[model samples]
Target: MDVLCESAPNDDDCGTRYSSSSSEDDERRDQGVAMTYMTLDSILNDNSRMFEFLRSFGVLANKYVCATCRKPMSCVKVATTRCGDGLMWRCAKDKVWRSVRKGTWFEKSKIKLKSIVLLTYCFCMRKSVQSTCRITGLSDKTVVDWFLSCREICSALMKKRGKIGGPGVVVEFGESSFGSNKYDKGRWMAEVWVWGAVVCGKDHGELVLNVVEKRDARTLQWFIEEHVENGTVIYSDKWDSYEDAEEFDLQSFAADHNYQFRNKVTGTMERYWKEVKRVLEGGKRRRSGLQSHLDEYIWRESVFVHGCAFHSFMQSVGALYVPRVED
Candidate 1:
């Protein structure tokens, strides 16, 4: 089987280097096989290939070492009637049947591991649920569930990264309402308030967005305290809610929308609002899991700006599962 090697910073020895001797060539070929697989065809056509790729991350192994006797463990494939039989590790000393996915996202999930990976790929590519379902030949519900799983994982990652703003960082803060237009006289309208803060830095920096109950001063102040760092200049449009920002120990700047303050950051924030609205564009706006959808946008925007959405999305998957400690 042909394998592709991903180049890293150190390219002194790269791309499956070969030697003149037959034995050396065979060794080099084996090393190439060990490298990560990327093609969709390879992953889908060969279940063993997909399992080998995931095994490299220790996903199939129960634990690196035995918890009871404090000894190294070995994992071997066991027969099962499930979607696919996973690895069952036996402690070299204890011989315990430990689970590889007992606590991770895949625990108790009957979905095939390869299918999950493909779902993640499609979601990260920003394909709509319908399109993803069609492409992957998965049911709509299954695709939606996997997409939300990715969003939840990415949300955790966003939280772990902490607030985006620091000293002297230019942060654009804005609040907008989602849902139906209130002006329509004949129809009932329901609106949900959303607060977003975008930090300006290289590669789109970071974004913190949340749903809020109200757009009052107290709510705005709480959002700043929770998501914005101290000493960072905050930008927002002229709104009564943000008037007391200074009192809350925040540096504030307001551009009067009426006067057409065309600052680039403010314009950028407006575009962000537009982009979000466009994503949620439809006649009926009272959608379930709105917050998750918004967060998915944040994750996609951040990764897209860096031009490595797929790589980052896959990395985020690895973060969701932790390796067992070695004794």
Candidate 2:
């Protein structure tokens, strides 16, 4: 045996090699951790923690004064609590908490704050109210109420924010019908005729659905004029109602698609109509309060645009209301 102890396999060298390998593994793990933290899904999943962490930065506070009485709300209770799913609060007052704003929408709703937050998230995520109810384990009626409250808020916010169109904006407008009745050859069946407009650049538009007596040019034109600004470049499917656009100084284009408006410019508005139809016709029996319920669906659709951060978008929408204090 050349010295009978082969120098113990160079203990220092082996230790150094092992340390180097461990260091490399640690670096790889750190990289993976960094990548995960940078993803939107990860952020959304951890929204509760993120919100709580953000409180330290003073993001949640009693900045909103009551819109009704104009009194400065003194306290804000921000927390993540559970009921149906998980509720995140940005409420005013300490003990018996209430949202800082009021009167515009979501007023006096007894639903848990978490339910509202989850409902809003689902709605923004394109989940229908029925699906939202199922996922959150809430009653259909409660889900409908949440939808209505959201819609009321959206409508109020949009009006306060002003007309959807800015100057020289090309806005596409169209009408579509939803719901059906087989009893009266679908004539006696109540149908909702939806009028919608989409602005080209601004992620802003309006939709109004009602039980229409007819779909004439006057009705269509009135709907367009009410929602879109004058002088917008309007496109429609050769409907006579659109023929009078020249009077309103709106540059008009007639699409060749009959009974179906196929202008790509109008695609967003058309998709919105389709989404509304899906909500109404999807398996569930049409509720008696469908129109009132649909208002929230429309509002939710309008607010959730591509590239918008859903949570922050809702917060901004929430901020649009001046808080109303009850006496």
Candidate 3:
């Protein structure tokens, strides 16, 4: 029996010996051994490799520390099964011993890391959660939970870096209303007004969306002050609420539709508003959780502008090393 180092090349590295009896069986066994070695190598080299490596060793490798308890984990094997796609490894830890578990923003989730990566890619590409579930072959509940977990991560990222658009940034601001039930006599149906601003640049400015109680001067000014810096150039349509721009020191300019404003120069903000509204209304569920949902919408828009894939963004987010207490 040849013992191969974990990093060594597969069975092909070893010289073959012919056994007169069952030569075919010997060849098949060698092939199987080679394939298994290759799979292990691939897993070890996987960029997204998380806890599985530690679990395979039967001791948490000190790196896969519990995010909550800050202690190394011990793999408590639960069950093993093979799905149509591949093998499944399920493990459990004491609630106290666990922290944010693999594949979750919280501790101790059973979802696979690969599934999370796939779902994140789908999300960054603007695929609906239902569509993502279909693509990943996950249940609706699982997909939704993953999405919410990702949203929490995204929110933490956004909070750490305050106000994306900064000094010398030129921003275009706009507002749109959805879920208005004027025809239904406006009983319990009130209009959900979304105020959006996109910085104007070679690409669209990182988008900011806020759900405003009303699109009044106070609200608009608040949005501008919160997201944009003073002395920034702001362009918008002629709205009375924007009249008090002098107080904010914002170089406010009104777009002239009669002049056929080009999208490259003047209509960038409007374009973002259109895109966000389209995405918000894309699903049949009609997002009723207004505030947090709008935050997520803005997050998606910003991600689109930054051209970040979901997993990459998540890794970059982790690099920020923000304290979990703030989250």
lDDT of 3 by residue, 202-227 (tens): 56357677667866666755676677
Residues forming the 10-long window of minimal summed lDDT in candidate 1? 253-262
Model 2 spans > 4 angstroms off: 1-107, 126-137, 164-169, 182-188, 200-218, 241-276, 279-309, 324-327
Instruction: State each model's CA lDDT, in order.
Output: 0.59, 0.46, 0.49
Q: Which runs in model 1 stand beyond 4 Å of their true positions?
A: 1-38, 44-48, 55-73, 78-87, 90-99, 181-189, 201-205, 239-265, 282-288, 305-307, 325-327
* Predicted candidate 1 versus true structure: per-residue lDDT over 1-327, tens digit per residue: 112122222333222222112222342232222112246435444444544555444444334567797775554444445226334455546666555455556676777666776777676666688988877789999997888788787777767767767666778877777776643557755877788988765455477778888777678667777787766667666444345644532233222211111224546566677878887663235445777777777777666644346556665666667654452
By TM-score, the best candidate is 1
Q: lDDT at 265 for candidate 1?
A: 51
- Compared to the true structure, candidate 1 yields what TM-score? 0.70
The positional error of residue 168 in candidate 1, measured at the CA in angstroms, is 2.5
Best candidate, lDDT-wise?
1
RMSD of 1: 10.0
Model 3 deviation from native, Cα RMSD in Å: 12.4
Measured against the true structure, the TM-scores of the candidates, in listed sequence, are 0.70, 0.50, 0.57
Lowest-sum lDDT 10-residue window in model 3: 253-262
